[model samples]
Target: MSFPDNTVLQSFPATLNHRNATIFTANRTDSSAQQAIEDLIDARLQLRDRVSAPLKGMENDLFAKSQPLDSLRPKLRVTFGRAKRDGAFDWPVEEVINTLGAQKRGAPVAGLYGFGYRKSALGLIQEFFIFTEMLDGHLNGLTWLKRERNIQNLIHVSFNLLHALHSKDIVHMDFWANNVMIDPQQPTRAKAIDLENCFLTPTDHLTEVLAFQFGFYYRREIFRFVIEHDYDRLVFEELGKYDGIDRRRFDEIYALSKHENISRRARREIFHKGTVVTG
Candidate 1:
């Protein structure tokens, strides 16, 4: 049996419920059997749910605005449902490309598209880009994680996974909370998504402006999403945990996060460090 490479597959539709939801077409697929299970874990963590998780009357209000997908140069169709059956494949194509190293058409996918773990794991959510505007107060996680420390696990997993990839020389151009997903119940291990704009540095060390930009954005998102999201929780969670627990955890998160210190400092070394700041 030979699965031909570079074969452009046509996507069909699967049933989904958009009622009282935000701007999105409800479809699922069957070919994404592997992703179904992976997405299930991600859905469990509620990363995408938090991002795309429609607001109260989000559907009613969404149509009022417009987006890139509204006119829709090229739209991706879903082909599976979460509740369809015991087994199904109905996740986004970006997810497919991440874990499966495949594509439906000539459309681009994230750099981590083909990067994934051995078994089922989460992937980034790309569906949010097709919008006129993002909803307000995605910072709602503050309220959700209020007075709880477990949420740190989610933050930890989301941030660290990207750092781990960066350590491997993968520069994730788009490093945002929305682009990462957490594995259900396992906050230590998460998945990175949206490689369409990501680039893997051929050389171990990348010394370009793009690397700096990627690092800067990655740093911003990690600080904003990971540390800020549940810093207090993590702090207390590590209370009496160990002598160097915090440092160890910090290193772990840094290793897994997509923000690379190398990428961040590489360009600066060439441009500003040596350049004299004349008064």
Candidate 2:
């Protein structure tokens, strides 16, 4: 029931997942490796203070009520602990709820019920977990687009969400299809999740985590599909309307984004920061 004393946890991979805590399962046959992994995980968890004091304080309160072993969820395979400096514990339940409310003006978002953290010998750890209503029959944007043909509504919904974030002085630095959930029940509407990287009028340095080129490339591809497939004018108009940029001007801006002479940083700033480029 307990990990061996010597497990060495692995660092997180660049590949994306909803949770920040990366779990490494112990191998009963290879006790040495499992122990090493567990030890590393323990060490990593104990050294971090990334979350706000209020959140950490709240988590400490929660931890006070439960045993560390009691915090483990078989489903998640994550050993819940105090918020870490790795930004895992930053999305406390209150923040998620507030963000959901803020996002109501744009697209639908999953509901967060509550959160909890755990304490260790090193004190409060930096990892935490949340409870949410399952986004039933939902898939990430990347997978959904590959299978679904009715792309217009999803695209519109994404723009709406982005515009809504912009209106609130928020920019979702991690605005990729993978982060956007497309629910089968709400085919036309997409829900934006993973707001951990979202920032309110974030400075360029703060938003360095965002992969602007990937998102811009995705949008450009979507734009091309709209044009090549001869999607209804209404769709184009709707995109322009929701995005707060003229529909007629999309091609021009997209062109500028792809220009070889333009610096990558400049292109990213133009595309993601909404810098208007006049002819």
Candidate 3:
């Protein structure tokens, strides 16, 4: 679909609300942003209790915050619940865009709208942007892995996602299958929807593996990739863990993964090396 010249498809309001929560682009009446907000509201209204697993307070809080939907957005796509270890009040959602920039590779993040606090109800809400076209939820975890028999495609897309973040000097502390979103049309490409625990640094590696889920050994190998800057090793090692992947498939995927990483690193090196001229 065509958009207007002044339209801000991946943009949000630059300020917070009176409650100090992040304000969404409710004021942008002419843009597609408003319609996106309406869609989120519609999705929330239609959400059933049985489907919301793990996220306990989802339905009640969504309904409570629904009245002022224009001024609010969900911290999670559909789920609702506080992190047992981390406090919801102090999440760094609003500042992430400024630190990390919007797009990684070709995929744009759902913009961070700010934070929302409502009395004794939903203490603090980390408001991030959402596009309905990308679907309201991410793939269901190992269930998806079982269904997705083409393991090579999953490895390439998932690893490319890691490479994209590491190239930016950003480490996604909580990397899990559920946090990732894959477009139905282009299943090969994946984008991260959750970014609350992301850390930015000039350092090449992240040593400690604190909080993680799904693929315990595989996740550690990803951390190893970040620490060692070994793209080939990551591809081979991760592929080795899955017995279903054949040698031919492994070689092909590994070659693509290696090529992409080398090209990415080369571009980064040149970009950071700056202008150098002989005297």
> TM-scores of the models, in the given order?
0.33, 0.44, 0.43
Put down candidate 3 lDDT per residue, 161-275, tens digits, no spaces.
6656655655554555555556655665666655545545433312111111122324433433333344345555644433343455345433333223323222222223421
Off by over 4 Å in 3: 1-22, 26-89, 92-108, 113-115, 119-143, 204-279
Residue range 144-195, candidate 2, lDDT tens digits: 7778765665566566655555556565655655667777777556666666
Q: What is the C-alpha lDDT of each candidate?
A: 0.33, 0.43, 0.37
In candidate 2, where is summed lDDT lowest over 10 consecutive residues? 4-13
How many pairs collide in each candidate, listed in order?
Answer: 27, 16, 3
Give lDDT: candidate 2, residue 150.
56
Q: Please give the lDDT score at residue 57 for candidate 3.
A: 26
Per-model root-mean-square deviation over C-alphas: 15.3, 14.2, 14.0
Ranking by TM-score: 2, 3, 1
For model 2 the TM-score comes to: 0.44
Stretches off by above 4 angstroms in model 2 are 1-107, 150-153, 167-169, 200-239, 242-279
- Name the lDDT value of residue 149 in candidate 2: 64
Residue 272's lDDT within candidate 1 is: 35
For the record, the alpha-carbon RMSD of candidate 2 to the native fold, in angstroms, is 14.2
Report how far residue 139 has shifted in candidate 3, in Å. 3.4
